[model samples]
Target: MRDVLGKLGAFAGALLAVAGVIAVASFVIGLLSGRVSFGGLLVAVVGAALIAGVARLGKVPSLLGGYSALVYLGLFLPIVIVVIYAFNSGRYVTVWGGFSTASFSRALHDDAITSSILRSFRIGLTTSIVSTLLGTAAALALARARAGVRTPAEVVILLTVVVPEVVIAIATLIFFVNVGFELGTTTMFLGHCVFNVSLVTLIVRARFLSMGDSLEEASRDLGAGPISTFWQVTLPRLAPAILAGGLLAFTFSFDDVVISNFTSGAGHETWPLHILSALRFGLTPTLNAAATLMIGVTLVGLALAALALRIGSRQGAADFSTSTT
Candidate 1:
């Protein structure tokens, strides 16, 4: 029954791929006649390629590949739809008048949107830096400590991860009020740092454990002090993980709405906060354009993080091999 079903699925996927290919070919022909714009033709080509790729996935040896294809569609189809609509000519987000750059222009030109975005970036960058520094230090301490000390500390730190974000936000708000600190960007930065430190600590500690203490010990044996060893040897090895943690922190800080809302002072709105407020008014294609830009930035950050990790691993391997030889 499973094998029969798989065959049927593959046949359906193949049919879809053929349809996409034909549509793309028609768009290309129209492009040559100056009937189709280059952007439209490019989009058609990419869509057809994606459809063919999925169809190829469906034909893989196991059922897992087919399942993955379904998951991919479910996850990204809505995003693709929204991205397509971001270029809508009309003010209404859903009603597609045609491909237009008006929304992109409005979104970029709007003073509130641009200012909020700049504010968000400032907060995100500040939070990530402070959290990364503190977390890296904590991770080093915990990783080198005795089991009795490390185990309890690990649980305490990871508790932040397990706790709900809303709960954390509320707790932070109460703490700020009790401490007599006015809710503002500083408070938001503090809240973000608290959560991100634990995240960074976990990532850095994992990397430390995996890489072992050999390099640090070698540095020490060569008469480098602890600080020098850490700066020269340990930190370089942990650079990829640290970068990944910082990127994660930046993303979370930038995207945070609930916490930012609870803690933001008068006249201080982050980009997410601006979007949330805009939703109360009818959503516009401008909002969609903003969202699409945010998604693009996030994807770029993730790609860089992945690339950094890959390069760091290769460099570490090369260094280890040279040392051994």
Candidate 2:
């Protein structure tokens, strides 16, 4: 009897979730059509309440699944809109201008956009390199340090990451100004490296800690010097983590707007800065095309990072298994 009730509760929760989704979709459509959707909103709210109540009755998985779907939808909906409207035939981004790829052509032909893109890429590349090298060194040092030193160092490093980015940006800007440094691409690059080094350090440190020093010991035992062992054994194993961290740093630098805004002095613009400046005038499909292209690049970078991490994990497991055998 309890099983039957549980099954029935699950079914009811599923129905409520479905109804809520349909109502939300209708609400969105009505909003797009320039109409207020009070009735649809009410239905969605009521459906959500019902689902929650069912969840309290032990249908939690169904409720959680629906919630997860909603969360993802909220997160990706705007990105989906931007990508879809990139091809809009209309000049403005919001209106349905029919499907056309002219915006992409315009974006490509625009010198300002192209130049900003190149500048961003250069800054991102430079930031990634600096972050990777410094972060790797920090990770190596921390791993060998005493607990007292490691704890303090880790707290300092994490503080750089956990502190608000706006604060970092403002602090970096003030410091540069006080030091009489010119704000330009160089400043922007330095600002990015500040936090990115911490990010890369955490990633590499995690990988380094998980990767035991047995392999390095083996190489040393076979008459390999520290430098030789690091080059031959340590580097090969650590490459995936380094690559993943670098890719992530590059992506963060590429997408950053706050630091770039604060540090990029007059006359120097990255792609994100360019987009912000363009937005003051109005939304254009060309901007949408550019954003869509950036989204594609970001997605590719993230995918590659995830793949590298997965590969590293698998390789580590294989190596551990071989050593144990």
Candidate 3:
């Protein structure tokens, strides 16, 4: 009876979610038409209440209820917008006309777009590698150290993580201008690296902290040299955290606009710069198409990374638990 109730609750929650989504859509449609109706919003709220109620009954998995939902946001919204625009034939992106791929062709053939994409990709890749390597070192150094050193290391990590992106971007740009530093992709890349290094460090270190201390002790007890122990023991164990942190850093560098906007000099444009400039001239199909592509790539790639890591971590833990049992 309880199992049946659970399944029923889950189904009700799912249906309520669908209704809530439809209501939100109706509200948006009404909003775009110059006046939003309370009726549509009321319907959405009611549906959301039902969904929340069912979710509270303990039928829905928290992963589904929370983490997965949060993670899917970037993927879900972008996909919906991209699909809508992919079929839009009109010159204007906002007002739909009919289905066509003309905008996509323009985006592909655009030299400036291509150049910016290449620039962003190169920067993202380089930044990911450099940041991950340095950050992981910092993470490992903090994670493996004695108790006395850990608190300071943690404080440093927190400062970087919590600092505002705009502050760093503006500060770096000013410093460059004052010192006569040549502003280009290289500077942008390095600027991104600064934030990314801290981000990666904090993420990897968090993972390291979650993993208990037994492995390192075991390695030490085996009379293995520190280097050999780290290589054979710690690195393999730390690989997942490293990879996760690196993926996050790569995505950060790829999607960054604020920092890139401030640092990129005249005549040199990253994809973000192109998009931002184009927006001032009004929205275009080409911009949507290009943006759609980046959004899709980043969302799918990152989602897959998240899914893979989640599964692997769960399986590894399960295996460890079973063996211990």
User: Model 3 scores what on Cα lDDT?
Assistant: 0.81
lDDT per residue for candidate 2 within 272-319, as digits (tens), equals 999999999998888989888878977896788688778878988999
All candidates in order of TM-score, best leading: 2, 1, 3
Tell me the deviation in Å of residue 268 in model 1. Answer: 1.1
lDDT of 3 by residue, 28-48 (tens): 777899776677778767866
For model 3, the stretches where C-alpha displacement exceeds 4 angstroms are 1-79, 144-148, 303-325
lDDT against the true structure, each candidate: 0.85, 0.86, 0.81
TM-score of each model, in listed order: 0.78, 0.79, 0.73
Residue 64 miss distance in model 1 (angstroms): 2.7
Clashes of each: 0, 0, 0
* lDDT at 12, model 2: 56
Better of 1 and 2 by lDDT: 2
For candidate 2, what is the TM-score?
0.79
lDDT of each residue in 1-325, candidate 1, tens digit only: 9977876676556556655766788788787887877777776877688676866676555434555566677799999988999988964678878898778888889999999999999999999999899999999999889999988988889888889888989999998999899988999998888789998999999999999898788889999998999889998879888988888888889988878988997888999999989999978888899888878887897788778778879988999899899
